[model samples]
Target: MPVPAKRRSSSKGRRGRANKGLAKKTLAKCSKCGKPTMPHHVCPFCGNYQGKEIIKSKVKKKAGSKK
Candidate 1:
């Protein structure tokens, strides 16, 4: 059994737990387009993540009537 000379500070043990909050990126910026995106998720502006297309936004082509 190990004994501490004085009161083992809670700060030492809190490093791992408290540091986790500060360890994460609050907002992930998109590389394709400069927009704020959530971590591990596709960018809403660029629709990409992890060098792959994740969110597929469709654009409807307009139909032309023959005269």
Candidate 2:
């Protein structure tokens, strides 16, 4: 195997790795509940996709304090 003729600079290495950093996720707004969600995917909050309801979400009741 061949080795490098000289030591690589930290800035050069960092420049090469610049594109390897994690990118921000792309999100889209849900048509039904108006929540942020991934595009072309089912909405978790309203369970809607492409103007249709894919899942039937259940309403949770709030617990009352006992007197």
Candidate 3:
């Protein structure tokens, strides 16, 4: 087994992590709702994918509940 001779410095570690920041997700417009969404995914706002309805998203009611 091998071991490091000395402890690593914080500056050196930070330099390596300089480019580790997360990149913003690329968004594509939903064909049906025309809203921004991730590519190749069902639209969360309208529950449609590739111009067709796929997963049925829950609908939110305004103000008080009907029941």
Mark the regions of model 3 whose C-alpha exceeds 4 Å error after superposition: 1-9, 12-19, 60-67
Worst 10 residues of 3 by lDDT: 57-66
Per-residue lDDT of model 1, residues 7-52, tens digit only: 7578877875776666655898887776788887888765688877
Q: For every model shown, what is its TM-score relative to the native structure? A: 0.42, 0.58, 0.59
Off by over 4 Å in 2: 1-19, 58-67
Q: Stretches of candidate 1 above 4 Å error? A: 1-25, 58-67
RMSD of candidates 1 onward, in order: 9.0, 6.3, 6.9
TM-score of 2: 0.58
Clashing pairs in 1: none
Encode model 3's per-residue lDDT on 1-67: one tens digit a residue.
9988997899999998998996899999999878899998899887899778887655423223557
Q: What local lDDT does model 1 show for residue 19?
A: 61
* Native RMSD of candidate 3 (Å): 6.9
